[model samples]
Target: MSENLKKDYQLCEEIGRGKFGTVFRCFSLVSGDDFACKSIDKRLLTDSLDRECLEKEAKIMQLVTGNPNIVQIFDVYEDDSYLHLVIELCNSSDLFDRISKRTFSESEATAVMLPLMEAIAHCHILGVAHRDIKPDNVLFNEWNLLKLADFGSADWFLGGKSMSGIFGTPYYVAPEVISGRDYNEKVDVWSSGVILYMMLAGIPPFYGESAGEIFEAVIRGNLRFPTRIFDSVSPAAKDLLRKMLCKDVSKRFSAEQVLSMSNSCLILIVLFKVEN
Candidate 1:
């Protein structure tokens, strides 16, 4: 821990852990406010590329803090051994945990997705791409509002400059990423599609016994809406998925376009049900 961190805050408890670091619940001494502190060890970031990504993640978080749906970073503390990030504390469970607890109707999913897409669009508009957009990275605030978290995979993407690395959770990764082709922010849209599919169907769009099998399925780019799971889902919802999960990156809908259509889609679904 940094001397500054020791002076300013008191560590409470370990809240979460991921491949990159451990997150702790902390209380600010001066403000009496609570925060999430991500402690990343310097030794684990020995690779130059990893270190660069770490720095960029912090910069991206700093750039996009004020957005209502994205997690906010308050302060940063560094020491010889670790880098600590003091961010908005979200005590509620992540979307994945919530989903595992129960199923979500299309309407409920839309309610969750609209703000998500808006936040994503906000990030893209600001030139940031959240390479990881899975449910585990989506947290709920005390108000029960969804907040996008974990910018460890986030970076700024300038127009006409595409990224080539394949970085994302397996089930939600875009096909182009699996193919090792250059991709852009649309990759996030594809991940959103996977999330949508999972939300409505209670399982990922692609699944297999092994990671290799899952990657093969993803690369194949076949979307399955099994009658048992999706027969009750709205056509408009399915249409949006088709557009979002398109194998051809050029055919994929942007976040702005999706947001424009999502409201109308939900409204139509509601009307159709009422009429029936």
Candidate 2:
């Protein structure tokens, strides 16, 4: 840990752990405010590409700092051994954990998704693509507000340019990404669509026993709504899902377009209403 970080904040319990770092619930020495401190071990980031991605993630988070739906990064500290990022602390569970606890109705899912879409729109508008958009990356604050976190796979694609390389979770990864084709921010839309499908039906649109199988299914890009599971789902919700999950990248709905539909009262109303 950095000496400067310890001097500034009191690191508390371990809240999260990943490949490169562990997240701690920290309290600021000056203000006594709670925050999450992600302390990354510099030794683990021996690869130049890994270091570059880490730098990019910080820059991207800083770029989208004002977005309400995205988690805010407050401070950064570095020493010879560790790099610490002090970010807004989210006391509640992640989206994956919350959804696992109970099923969501259309209105409830819509409520959760609107803010998430807004977050994605904000990132896209800033020319940043959050290559990873799985439910685990979506968190909730103490007030139960949604916050999009983890930009490890994020990168810039300014001016609508395409990005290459495959960087996303298997189940939520876009087809273009799996195929090794140059893709754009629209990949986030596809991942969001997968999340919506999972939320509404209580299952993923595609599945398999192994990562390879899941990747194949994602590449095939066949979206199906089984009658038994989706019988209660509204047509408007399904329509939006189809648009977001469209295999044809050229025809897929952009984050802004989805926000536009959400902004329209008719679509919003239709999406929120439960079918008889």
Candidate 3:
């Protein structure tokens, strides 16, 4: 632990753990404000790529800090052995845990998705792409407001340029990414679409016994809505999914377009008092 970090905050019990490090509940000594300190073990970053990713995560978090749905990073501290990130504390369960607990109504799913897409749009507008956007990275605060966290796989994609990398979770990765093609920020939109599909259908649109199988299914890009599972899902919702999950990058809807369609439905819901 860094001496400066210890002097500035009081680290409490561990709150979460991941492949790279542990997150702890911490309190500021000066203001008594609560925060999460993600302490990354430097020893585990065994290669140059791992070190670059750590730095990029911190930079991207800071770059998108002001968005309402993106988690905030308050401070960064580095010592010889560990790197610490003081981030906004979110006490509620992650989206994955919440989804596993119960089924969601279309309205409920819409509510969750609106803020999430907003966050993605914000990132894209700022020239950043959140390559990894699975449910595990979606957090909630005490008030149940959604927050997009963990930008470990985020990168810049400015001026409509394509980015080349295989960076994303299997279940939600874009088809272009699976094919090893140069992709842009639209990849995040595809991942968000998968999240929406999971929310409504109670499962991912593409699946397999292993990551390789999942990638094959993704690359094949055969999007379907099983009648039994999607019988109750609204047509407008399905239309949005089709646009978002389109394999052809040129045909896929951007984050802003998805938000526009969603907002339009929300307007109709208000006028006609519809459930969808």
The numbered model that scores best in TM-score is 1
Top lDDT prediction, candidate number: 3
Candidate 1: residue 225 lDDT (0-100) = 83
The total number of steric clashes, by the backbone 3 Å criterion, in model 3 comes to 0
In model 3, which runs have C-alpha deviations exceeding 4 angstroms?
Answer: 268-276
Candidate 2 residue spans exceeding 4 A from truth:
263-275
The TM-score measured for candidate 2 stands at: 0.95
Question: How do the predictions measure up, each by TM-score?
Answer: 0.97, 0.95, 0.96
What is the lDDT ranking, best to worst?
3, 1, 2
Give per-residue CA lDDT, model 1, range 94-163, as digits (tens): 8999788877888899999999999999999998889999999999999998999998888778876788
Model 1: worst 10 consecutive residues (lDDT sum): 155-164
What ranking of all candidate models by TM-score puts the best one first? 1, 3, 2
Q: Quote the lDDT for 65 in model 1.
A: 92
Candidate 3 lowest-lDDT run of ten: 267-276
Instruction: Write one digit per residue (lDDT tens) for candidate 3, span 2-56.
Output: 9999999999999999888999999999999999999999889997877888988
Q: What is candidate 2's CA lDDT for residue 128?
A: 93
Flag clash pairs in model 2: none
List ranges where model 1 is wrong by over 4 Å. Answer: none
Between prediction 1 and prediction 2, the one with superior lDDT is: 1
How much does candidate 1 score in TM-score? 0.97
